[model samples]
Target chain A: MNAILECKGLTKSYGGKKALSDVNLTIERGRIVGLLGPNGSGKTTLIKLANALLTPTSGEIRIAGMKPGTGTKKIVSYLPERNYLNDWMRVHDIIGLFRDFYGDFRPDKAYDMLKRLNINPNDKLKTMSKGTKEKVQLILVMSREAELYLLDEPIGGVDPAARDYILETIISNYNPEATIIISTHLISDVEKILDHVIFIREGQVVLSSSVDEIREQGKSVDGLFREVFRC
Target chain B: MLGKLLKYELKATGRTFMPIYAAMLIAAAVTKLISALTAGGSEVPEFISAIVYIMILMGMFVMTFVVMIQRFHKNLLSDEGYLMFTLPVEPWQHIVSKLLISVLWNLGSLVAAFLSIVILTFDEIANRALMLDLFAVIAEFLTIFGPTGSLVVLEIFLAGIATTVFGILLIYASIALGHLSNRHRTMASLGAFLGLTAFAQILFACLTLIPNVRVLQHYMDTLQESLQTSIALFHYVMWFTIGFFTLLSAGYFLITNHILKKRLNLE
Candidate 1:
């Protein structure tokens, strides 16, 4: 259970281009790990594989010693990068859907967050602005009492103000035993909360270390990211 | 888990279909009322209302087809797959839930159309006898076969359900196959559906050319013989039809589930 996610030589390719190649990694529980990478750097690919949205081309990725399937999905809550919410449903109905499908989902907590954000539960998703929809999706994900939370670019699409609120919601909601992997190129905004970071570039893991380790070397995660992924 | 999936699937799809059904029934009622008012007068108003009824009928049919395809593609193969596929439900449950809901809507559309037609034609005096006569004829036809008669009716009902399930699964299978391509998914899905239809036709043709001719000759001969032989033969053919469609539906369901589980790449 300590290694919440373990990838053993995981490889995934699209057509002839490899998204991730023979990668091996382990993410432990009870830590906020930043899957830090530039665009098209295989961060999302790894996340999708973990979520069972896409199967690996070869090798294996396991969650809590099990392959990605219904069992793992029960413990994993995902906030995808896109607006996956249907335009037809109200926020209340969508919350009901989450509560219906995921036993870990907490509708009361979701409603409370919506109220704090001034989002009406009765409002249809289509009428909401892009930022508002993103906030709503984040609230749904954070409201889940899941063992692992996979937030794919949770703050990437929001304003600086909303990003702070989203980060605050995520930090305060997740229990100590749960792990959160926030994948984004906005490394500076998320650096303060990340206990560890995994630097990926061109579908390869270049670095996996604790924040204190980087700080001990007199380098901020943001500065280190800029230097490592410099164009 | 499957029950939960179906509950939400019904909720999501009900919004589009329920309105179409209600509109169709309303148009039918209006057509009936207009005809009753005009009774032997100018036919123009009746014709116009009939036209409106037909237009609504067309809308129902088109929406049935569109909703079946759109629900699967938009819900599972689009961005929404991020939500659906991640559910703690198994992939097959998603397939089954969507398939069951599609079959329900398909049957619902048919039932609505039938009821609308009944409303359009019903008259308290004239059609009462007509309806009774129709039922009497059906009852007499069934009585001719004795006990096997009711079994024949049941088999026919099963065949209808099997065909409906098979048809929907074919579309689901095609969509899943098309999703494996790199681009132009709608066109690819259309192609896959055409290919599957052609393949089924060819297979049926091949089967007919083989032992099917002899089976048909034997079946016809049994109709000329004793009652028991004829009943047995009827049972054989009816079961074959139901079993064949059920088997094909299972294959398509498997194809859809496997593709969605293994090769899904949502944009």
Candidate 2:
């Protein structure tokens, strides 16, 4: 496999409950992979493992042929589900922080994104609406010219217009030599832009295939999701 | 990268600390001004003025601990951890950044506290003899404890600095350990902190009782009234305090690093 992301017997658990279990997967570079799963279907667990936010139970995860640490963190840009920006800092301060830490961060590009969305650079995060804060986070993550992007629920909690903008931002900003793994519940909204899709269910990988392959089977990705994970 | 982390750490803390320090200094000046203006008119209650000064110092002291705890918890264990740990820096950089900034602020508050007291309470008219009064104080201590008393005093002062830094790192280590909990993290941290403090205090208290009381008793029984003996005892006590806290500081630093690197559960 020409993989940019790889997991071997990867397992993670909290207490006695398994979040992910004995899973092996790989995603090639230069593709937008949608990590589709139910709310507690281990999608975020897998992503967090990749980000080094959570340690595994029994196995290993590798990104870009290296373990997750200072080295891999250099090339992996992560957009967490929660609002992680410090409320007291101005928008520009966060951009400065990104610039300071990530060598791949493009401040000009981030500024352009911020201006396009009408966010004031000098505004504190507490002054911004929740939607604006989410947009700012997306802008920072997307501005990084990293080898891997792990965005967890990127389009959630935003208006449709902003949602469209975020999706378009993801599409237009895709680097042919890099990989993007977006984990979200709004599969239909993101399916059109996704090049590959993986469906996880209850700590197991139920399906992993390309979007074209799902279409060749005469089924929309969203349709297959509902069929696979119905209540 | 370490420099950048330190810069941001300072920036993050300076905003709140600077304002508090300025307000305390201003309040001290205002109290002095009121006392100066009322020197001849009517008696301003000394107790009330004393309270104002003490309260400012106490607030600064308490907030030193509070702010350090909050900064470590909120910055490294809360949602902000997602931003921090993802940065292209080793986890130790984060710990060191917090440690250095915390020590800087702790020492800064102490200096500010001392200066505020001097500014508020010093009387210029009596200040004409302040130099002689200082020498008189030195001579008094010297007669009681001898020449090495000065060295012991210096060592004690240095020990105070080490103790503060070590105590702060103990809190950091406790909080790092508490971060292992998915629920009750705050409570866990508080318990760890109190437990560690009690452990260190008990350990140090036992060590103190072993020699301080016994040595003095032995000196008295032997009828050896040499000032040099007292000076030697003073030096040993000061160095012991300094060495003990330095050891605590190193131990806490290692434990904090271990938990942060191996058992990190930033929920």
Chain B alone vs. reference chain B, TM-score for every model: 0.92, 0.85
Q: Worst ten-residue run, lDDT, model 1 chain A?
A: A156-165
Off by over 4 Å in 2: B43-54, B139-150, B205-225
Docking class of 1: high
Per-residue alpha-carbon lDDT of candidate 1 for residues B131-233, written as tens digits (9 for 90 to 100)? 7888899999898778788998999999999988988999999999899887788899999999988887786677556867887777777776667677676
What does candidate 2's lDDT look like per residue over A41-141, in tens digits? 99888988888888888899999889888889999999999999998999999999999989999999999989988899999999988889999999999
Instruction: Give the per-residue lDDT of model 2 (tens digit) for B1-267.
Output: 999999999999999899889888887887787788777766556447767767877898888888898888899888999999899888889988998899899989988987787777678535768758888987897667655657766796789789878978998989987787777887998888898889889988887887579887866675576566656666777898898899889888898988877777666
Clashes of each: 0, 0
Lowest-sum lDDT 10-residue window in model 2 chain B? B41-50
Off by over 4 Å in 1: B124-127, B219-233
